[model samples]
Target: METNEILRNQIFEIIKNQLKHNNPPETKITLDRLRAQGFNDSQARQMIGQCISVEIYQIMKTNEPYNNARYIENLQKLPKEPFE
Candidate 1:
């Protein structure tokens, strides 16, 4: 459990850093990048999902005049595994 938590944190940090460096903060992260970072397929997928969830949360917090419809729409735009 401890190891899993540590790995998850590392994956999250990598994804976050990549996003931060992008000119427009890409909506999708490639599996190739995650694999190059040493994550297996399942781990990569989990990390991508976590990244999307975090982005959704950030959007919810930062966007003004929050609209439920827009929030859901934005979430639907987030990258999904196997396709990203």
Candidate 2:
């Protein structure tokens, strides 16, 4: 697979793994949902991975809250150009 495709799949897997104990991965909010929330396609996907990274970062450090403010902060750290 192309590098971008591999990265997309990796992000999907990470999102899936994060949802493992909650609901089925297929049922979890995804990049598509993020798009529905007004983010463009690339933004949505980048935000998806960023969200997961935020969750994992919090977990590894401590059980930090994954609230909207925190998410927005993480989103801001993403490159203006998607997936660079």
Cα displacement (Å) at residue 81, model 1: 17
Residues 1-84, candidate 2: write the lDDT tens digits.
899788668877766665575333422455445566687876666666766555556766777665555554444554343221
lDDT of model number 2: 0.57
Q: Please report, as a residue range, the 10-residue window in candidate 2 with the lowest summed lDDT.
A: 75-84
- Candidate 1 CA-lDDT value: 0.52
Model 2: lDDT of residue 13 = 79
TM-score of each: 0.36, 0.38
TM accuracy, model 1? 0.36
lDDT of each: 0.52, 0.57
Per-residue lDDT of 1-84 in model 1, one digit per residue for the tens? 698687667756655665577522332345556566687867765656565455455667777443445433443443342221
* Error at 1, model 1, angstroms: 23
